[model samples]
Target: MEINQWLNSAWFWVGIVLFIVIIRDIFIQKSHTITHNFPVVGHIRYWLEQIGPELRQYIVANNREELPFNRQERSWIYASSKNENNLQGFGTDQDFNSPGYIFIKNAMMGYNPPVNHPSKKNPGVLPATKVIGLFHNRKRPFRPYSVINISGMSYGSLSAKAVESLNKGAQLAGCYHNTGEGSLSPYHQFGADVILNIGTAYFGVRELDGTFSMDKLKQKVDENPQLRAIELKLSQGAKPGKGGMLPASKINQEIADIRHIPMGKDAISPAFHAQFSNIPEMVDFIESMATETGLPVGVKSAIGKLEQWEELAAYMAKTGKGPDFITIDGGEGGTGAAPHAFADHVSMPFTFAFAKVYQIFQRHDLTDKIFFIASGKLGFPEKALLAFAMGADSINIAREAMMSIGCIQAQKCHTNHCPTGIATSNKWLQAGIDVTLKSERYYRYHYTLVKEIAEITHACGYEHPCQMTMDDIELSMGDNNRTMTLSKAYGYHKTAIAYEYFNELIDCPHLGGANARNRLSR
Candidate 1:
């Protein structure tokens, strides 16, 4: 009787339930191949696979060992935004002896003496604000309210909440937010300065016939007193010499209405502009747009083929008709969606491209007339300082800004399933983002970055960032344990034979060098 009672207990029922579940998982579940082979044990593999990314980030991956962005980089951005303890306990995790290492040369005597300075005890100091587009010929050339501003991230590519947060942040930061090619939405009118970017698709300024509409452009500029400039997007770094596609699934009625395209259809941007094909036509288009907008009109491009740029510069010099500013996007720049090939192996990197473009414009004596905005992985102050030293009038921050607004770098931006509520249009995901809170983070991040730039400039003995020259930075060639100043690296030295070391051979006309070899081969 005792044996019978024990067998009929609750434990007997639980055992039976477990056995049934195991049997079903091992035999009945055909969807999972591993589960069929390993029975209940196979479920462990599925759970581990589900948590693999998180596991790597939290445990397996070290702070300095990650791609695109390391833990240290992300932590700095986050800590600076929150005003938290960002200082590391020990020294830097950087490999100082590594090849291709770059660093700024601090001066023994800074611009202002430490003895008389109020913040002598402190490590950071504020530098004078640098003005951009001052010499440009425009009815209202942008003075650049801030040297660091938000880069182009489209409305449709980002959620509405994200756009509003960014716009508000721009307002708080006293900077400008670029209205990307996705067209202008009401959320963009958050009392912030705006830059209207017109792409091949001509989103906001397109007519029913799919050509650029001057009337619409004029209306937008006239209505928005805060619309500071207009940027004509010839190409971006992510996909140079290629167009973009917005899948129908991502496009809603509001997006369709804004873009002036039908809903539930793949919105295609052509590879090249329809308004102009040749160089002369393109120049004419920019001049016409500047005249219509009365705001500084600029062209944004990713560097490719130095000869093509030379031709453009030469023509602009000849006609004196060109953009008031030029934004150079490096190949490493990020995009919401792009083809793998184009993103990986298309355009020149930022530092090299920036140096080449600056040399070309300087050679043509057009540098004084046009402003240069550099972008591509320039999230850190060191990188921005490098750009300023390389002749960039200003720098644009894109991916880092996204991180400030709560992007987890999931790399799922192409899909609408972004978990962070940033690169997604899904309502459920977007709900996770609190605009008010995130906007504060954006403000803090921008403030910290601008402050850091000033601090670095002061440390380098410069009164302002604009005063930073290539001479202030040094690059490790990693060949023969050699070091070269940025001026020497970019061939800005006084010596005539300095051109031999430059990568842009077209600019170097000296005989018996690589230029001569090219001529002989041709």
Candidate 2:
């Protein structure tokens, strides 16, 4: 082609346009140092950085190398959610010799329920052995139908479709869904029982000035029959002692309406509750809420200092008036956006934190009184078993539930760009989730998880997971092939309170409906 003809060609015109745009971006855009310094070539670096997580997840990293949720863990959840074959062929890839390794001590003769057992007929329907608020005599005390329930992941932090799917799934699976600290949005009303999590800002039941309002709380409870309980958020695992701030830019009208906050202004949650400053006052506040709402009241917190927990336990033991349940969140828990330092090092991990708090309550003889809930990565059957053995009456799962509904753990939760639509609120991104289909997926995941836990329980000669004690667990000490009982390692002896409760229920004719034989299945 002639030089004049080349200059007038389409390719030549495209090059000219690109060159002009690049020159303008290089000089005018000072926000990105690399692009400003290296011009068009630096664009390649940003693109690579943008997709770095995907490349590492799918191509570079091994199955177990990823953080938060590795390929193996994610695969198990995905397969379980889809009701696919999740059984491993070549045994575990775990390093048995590794220090801190834990495993359940299977009984020589596995437990076999009677042919007429509810579990045999309905598989995966393990109900709580103890009622949630029976001890407190709340106006509406009831036993939780499933031991495994969905943990809190706020509607604002997650998409509306995600919340709706989770609620529907919880309903199908006979499990409760936690309306996270963001408040009770319409999406959380899909016929599932809800534990309303009231954070420091008191989102759903807050006054115009962001203070907690008892009248508003009563109205919420009265309006939503599904609001079975309330969880006062003292702190979360991801950011202990740190309050949250929802940027005005991310606060849409829906969020503003749900949270009862004005739009176009930052919604700030202070580090501490304005209602109570000390343990006694906090107990009074909890009791007041329980009285007003006629529902069980609980507190969720990540452990740091021991003094506050000890004080709370001591006070509760003395007065017998406090939270009906206590949920211990581990430092490893995620879902909320947090500072790197706070997320990594602020609070104790679940096992250690739970041990400390459990010991404190045990010392006060309050262990059997309050419903103990465990959170933070207790999704898998083995992990969940360990938690129950450590004295957890129930377990809550957040990330695992999100994964079941289509989260790839892209870790873009804080960026409003989740690819699978579980985390992000962006309409285009959220359109990826089919509420009905994903809801079924979540149901399958929950049902399968509870079923597997029951299978493991029966293998361990136990009727229910809560009946397990630390004596049934062992951990490697990282010494010369040394092993230690979980009870000894944690420096506490877990009582057979749950087992005793199970026995009592089985003995009573009227309460037989709550027994393992009549528990929900399938």
Candidate 3:
């Protein structure tokens, strides 16, 4: 009677049927070679592969072993965004003996009587903000409320809801959001300051022929009251000297209309700007744009050869004018889509490039005229302090901000399958994002980061980041016994230019014979 009851059980019957079906399909299916060979057993391998990332994240890898951003770094960002307790017991998981490690030279005690104003109600302190474009050339200068700001993630690269949330967060946090190369969308109209970035393709200000249009640009600036400044993008760190890539899946009607491109097609900017091929032409282009908009204009580029930078500085010094600022991006920058070769192999990393560029500007006495904005993977207070020590007046952040808005760092940005709804254009994916809630998270993250910077500055015996110099930073030599400060390691100072090299290159009558002159003129 017991045997008959067991045989008649619903669960027993269902399990038997399921097993029979799986065995039959595994053998019958010809598509997958492994399944055809191994039958039911092969599915286990496929299932494990499907859940590999989560398994590695939760069960296999340690806190600091991941790339792009480690588990511990992401945890801090998430906690800060939620305004949750981010404190951890004991010391850090970082390996102090690791090569190229960076650490600050902390003071014995806090800055005298607290550099920031004393607060009775709220004990937390705030970092003092700085002003950009403060030189005599500009009619208006932009004083951002914080030195850390949202970097150039475009509207098409992000969803409408994401862009709206970031803009709202920028407004709430008293910072600014950069409108990336895709140009302006209506979603960017939230009450916040904006840095309108014009890439090689000249999206928002481009004419029907794909050339820059002064009328369109003037109209755009006129319409958007939140416009604070303009950035002319020469190259970015992820793919220096290459244009941006927008996959066809994200190119909706709204994005196509704003970018003035055809719908249902991949939008790729030109590798180089067509408007200017020479230094004089580039300078003229920037001056004209600044004159037209009456807004401070700047150029953004990733470092290539050091000599090219010296040449650029020499040109600006000789010409007596150039862009109001120059944004230097590190090679580790994030991108929506790029060739793996360019993203990994091209451009100088931020630390080396920032130090070199800062020295060049100082050598030519152009530091006062052109502000330096450092970007690329500087999301936390320690990294931000390192940037200030390296001579960056302000900094930009992208991936960390995305993390605050629910991005899981799945690294599916190039694919349209961003599970968190931050990078995809699919309405179904975008539905997961709640703009109001995410905006608050964004504000809180920025607020917390800024407060931490203030606290670190006080601990470093400086009233502000500007007061802290290369003397305050120490780079580990990896031997665990030796370290060096920024001032000594840089070893760069003003010196007379090599007149012979310049005279032969620039003012030579033959310019190394007529053939060379003709080749250069063309």
Winning model by TM-score: 2
How much lDDT does each candidate structure score? Answer: 0.78, 0.87, 0.77
lDDT of 3 by residue, 1-522 (tens): 999999999989988976885777666677888876775668888999988988988789899998888899999999999999988889877877676678788998767542433321222323223335556366555554457778888888888898999988877776678998988888887876789999988888887567888889989988886787899998888888877778687677888889887777788798999999877888899888888887888888889788867877898898877888888989886755678889888988888888888888888888756667889889898899988877776788988899988888887887777898888787899999999999999988887887787678878986566556777887777866788887787865322221122123224422222122222232
Q: In terms of lDDT, which candidate is stronger, 1 or 3?
A: 1
Model 2, poorest ten-residue lDDT window? 509-518
Error of 1 at 256 (Å): 1.9
Model 1, which residues run further than 4 Å from truth? 1-50, 113-136, 479-481, 493-522
Please give the lDDT score at residue 144 for candidate 2. Answer: 72
Which lDDT tens digits does candidate 1 get at residues 1-522? 998998889998888887886899886877988887876678888999988887888789999888678888999999987777767887878876566467898888777635844235323222113223345467765555567888898888988999999999877766678888887788788977788889999987887557889999899889887788888998999998888898898888888878778766898888889999988998889888888877778899999889878988899899888777889999985855678888888999998888888888788888766778989989788888888888777788888998988988887888888899899899999999999999989988887887777777878896557668788888887756778888988787211111111122223322111122233222
Which candidate, 1 or 2, would have the higher lDDT against the true structure?
A: 2
Using all chains and alpha carbons, the TM-scores for the candidates as numbered come to 0.84, 0.93, 0.86
Per-model clash counts, in order, read 0, 2, 0
lDDT of 1 at 216: 91
List pairs with backbone clashes in candidate 1: none
- lDDT over C-alpha atoms for residue 420 of model 3: 85
